[model samples]
Target: MPMPQEYQLASQHYESFLTAAREALHLTTRNQTYTCVQATLLVFRHRLTAEQILMFADTLPAVLRAIFTSGWSIDDFKPEFGDEGDWKAEVKAVRVDHNFSNDETPARVAAVLRQHVDLPRFEKVLQQIGPDALRFWGFEASARI
Candidate 1:
């Protein structure tokens, strides 16, 4: 079979995602957006089992899939989903000087991400993973964005 479009246009797709994320976060540079996005991905990743993470990653675009799973360790302790403040703090902790993630970061990133994925499959995976997963990604159980 021919190479997948995601693989063929990997750089283009990643740039598009970074552009959208930068705009959504109102960030001045792609580097700031990258730090925030990576940190946010890790915050969510810490709550999922390996199997669930794989299921979710399968729905992402090529570059995003790599970002979501990079440097993951299944042996790490999975933290419980806590308050939004703590989550935001965690997002800001990565490359602390560069990360500019705020309380709305996850929601903004989620909005941008929805535009790049198979929404139905993405939502299905979120639903299967349970309510906390849905909320972590700034999605509501019955709401479609």
Candidate 2:
């Protein structure tokens, strides 16, 4: 009957996430943090099947769900999960000139995200998505968060 809390407070939640991400990444601005977070999410998105991507997005907070799905092209080629270095390269390539993502971006973003989401549910989805997804988010396949 009424609007959801997530919708009502979407801006607050998103700003809080950006604040946390900026602190975790040691960045000075939300724009920089946004680019880094977006890039990291895109790198992971490119590795998932369309269905898996939707499943993963479902576990995210409202604003993050929006971020995850924004600009997605179902027809785009899915990339294989290469080494961690490859992941970082892809993340940093998002907006090459403005991107500030680094080697620790994915793991750091994961840490911040874990604090904001329902960890058990998130981990469960990651598990369902398979081990590579777990590793992409900086969790060991057998590890429980």
Best by TM-score: 2
Model 2 ranges off by over 4 Å: 143-145
lDDT (Cα, tens digit) per residue for candidate 1, span 1-145: 9998879998999999999999999999988899888988888888889889899999999999999999999874366777678778788777887778887888888889888888889888999988878877768756742
Pairs of residues at least 3 apart in sequence or in different chains that clash in candidate 1: none
| Top-lDDT candidate index | 2
lDDT of 1: 0.85
Candidate 2 residue-wise lDDT, 1-145, digit = tens: 8999978998898889889999999999888999999998888998888899999999998989999999899875476778788888888889999998888898899889988888889989999988888988878986653
Compute the lDDT of residue 123 as modeled in candidate 1: 86
TM-score per candidate, in order?
0.91, 0.93
Tell how far residue 8 is off in model 2, in angstroms.
Answer: 1.3
The 10-residue segment with the lowest total lDDT in model 2: 74-83
Predictions in order: lDDT: 0.85, 0.88
